[model samples]
Target: MTSPRFVIIGAGLAGAKTAESLRAKGFNGQVTIVGDEEQLPYERPPLSKDYLVGNAARDSLYVHDAEWYSDQRVELRTGIRATRIDRTSRRVELSDGAGLGYDKLLLATGASPRLLPDTAGVHYLRRIEDSDRLKRLFTTAASLIVVGGGWIGLEAAAAARQAGLAATVVEALELPLLPALGRDVATVFADLHRQHGVDLRLGIQVEHVGNDGQGTRVRLADGSVLEADAVVAGIGAVPNTGLAEACGLRVDNGVVVDANLRTSDPDIFAAGDVASVYHPLLGRHLRVEHWASALKQPAAAAASMLDKDEAYDELPYFYTDQYDLGMEFLGTIDGHDRVVFRGDLPGREFIAFWLKNNRVRAGMNVNIWDVTGPIKALIRAGRPVHPDRLADPGIPLDQVATA
Candidate 1:
């Protein structure tokens, strides 16, 4: 009998890691990875932070060395797109008029940045090329106008400030990251950027973006205009679910998957930004588009494909580095009512917790290192705690769980 064949779509971190996990788990069958990008599989976080600012080397972005695939007997098919999935025949149709039969399949198609309505003179930060273009613009540009005050926009603004460029951020919301971090915590970011000399235009919309003879021009809803050498739009991202939807694999906001990362079809699985996984702890489906999910979900997907059946119930995790502030957030604030902070909020060194009915739901550590384990423990504890004890700096995090 022929050995079982495994095929993975998308060649980002999740796809690369899934292939690595499969080999580690002793899947000696034929393995193939299909990606549309010409470059090797790489991580996306640095594209906005270190790589964007020229602090990180380009070679550092790749997941593994170029020779790793050949050494492991894994077929790395870059610059090829997976156009369709033939479920009945268990094959994947390629853009180059080729097909690969698979006993099991994994989709880690990731996501693309949402473009501005008028993208004539707008830039986005999703791929390496995008960051390279921004880096080149920063070297010569005198000013930058960033649209959408989300993480990507904020990080790019911070990079622009670092490059000595005048930066302005425009957001429709009252505060940046309001929906994700809530008002109290989001205020900290608003202040952080303002203190760094970023001209933030909040609760406002961009009327239009176009290029003039001098440079890029931005028209605001308030009948105001601003010109800059470049403009970047980091509004949000949409999952790459066209292949999944075409194959009828059940797609909601993304490809819906069970606790084990197994999609509607038993033979197909999904991970990374494209998978809306059911969280056992939250008791609902949560789709996370963060580095942590992309880095960690592949292991569970590999195990599920091998019939190991271990649930991927890890709490959502993400972190950011902007200017001098470094933060790590764990869990989600889905239904939290209030936030409690420990440490110095004014000094930007603190740990904030989101609680629902006195039970910890999420936590964020700002410039506070070596506390992620404790924060994760508190969220997983799922028990009520005294607000006073949680707020007290003298009390240990582990002890605060019962206090």
Candidate 2:
């Protein structure tokens, strides 16, 4: 009998990691990775930060060198797109007219940046080419306009400030990160950027944009205009669920998966931003687009594929760095009513906990490193914590979880 074959789509971190995990889990079958990008699978987090700032080199962005893939006996079909998944034949049809059969398949086709109607000098940062273009544009550009006040947009604005360019951010919401952090916490970011010389315009919408000889003109809804050398729209991202949806898989919110990250078809699985798995903590399907989820989900996916009874049940975690503030946030803040702070918010060093009925539901530590474990413990305990003790730095978080 021929050895079982495993095929993975979308050679980003999740796909690459799934291949590595399959070997670690002792699946030792024929493994093939298909990706649309010409380059090898690389990390995306640095593209907006270190890579954009010129502190990191291109080669460092790759998850693993070419030798690692060859050493692991993994076939890499880069620069090729997986056009269709033939469920009846258990094969994936490639754009090059080749069909690869797979006993088990994993789809990790990541998301693409949400775009706006095109105008000259407009940019969207998602791939290596996007960052490279911004690098060249930043060299000579004196002013930049950033659309959308989310993490991506703010990070880009921070990079522009670091580049000594005048950065102005336009956000339609009242405050940046309002959807995720709520107004109270989001205001902190608004102040942080303003203090760093970022001209943050809130509660405004961009009606239209056009490029002319002077520069790029961004027209506002209230009959105002802003000019800049270049404009970047970092509104959000939409998952690449075309292949999964086309194959007749359930795609509510995202490709719906159970606790095991298996799609509607038993032989197929998905992990990453594209797969909306049932979250134990949230009591519903939650689709996270953070780097931590992409890094961690593949292990569970590989294990489940091998019938190991593994489940992706860990709470979500993500981090960011802007100017001098570095933060690690654990868990979601949905249904959270009150926020309790430990340490000094004015000093920009503290841990904030979101409480739902006095139970710690989520926590964020800013400029306070190495307490993620304790924070997660408090959240997972699901016990009511005294607001005073939670607000007091004198009490360690682990003790608070128990007390």
Candidate maximizing lDDT:
1
Please report, in order, the local distance difference test score of every candidate based on alpha carbons. 0.95, 0.92
What clash pairs does model 1 have? none
True-structure lDDT of candidate 1: 0.95
**Local lDDT at 177 for model 2:** 96
lDDT of model number 2 = 0.92
Give each model a TM-score: 0.99, 0.98
Give lDDT tens digits, candidate 1, residues 51-150: 9999999899999988999999889999999999999999999999999999999999999998888998799999999999999999999999999999
lDDT of 2 by residue, 1-403 (tens): 8999999999999999999999999888899999999999999988889899898999999999999999999999999999999999999999998999999999999899888776466899889999989988889999999999999899999999999999999999999999989877898899999999999999999889898867899999899999999999999999999999999999986789888989999999999989999987678999999999889999999998897878888898889989899999999999899999899898899999999999988899999989998998888889988898889999877667534
Worst 10 residues of 1 by lDDT: 394-403
After superposition, candidate 1 runs with Cα above 4 Å error: none
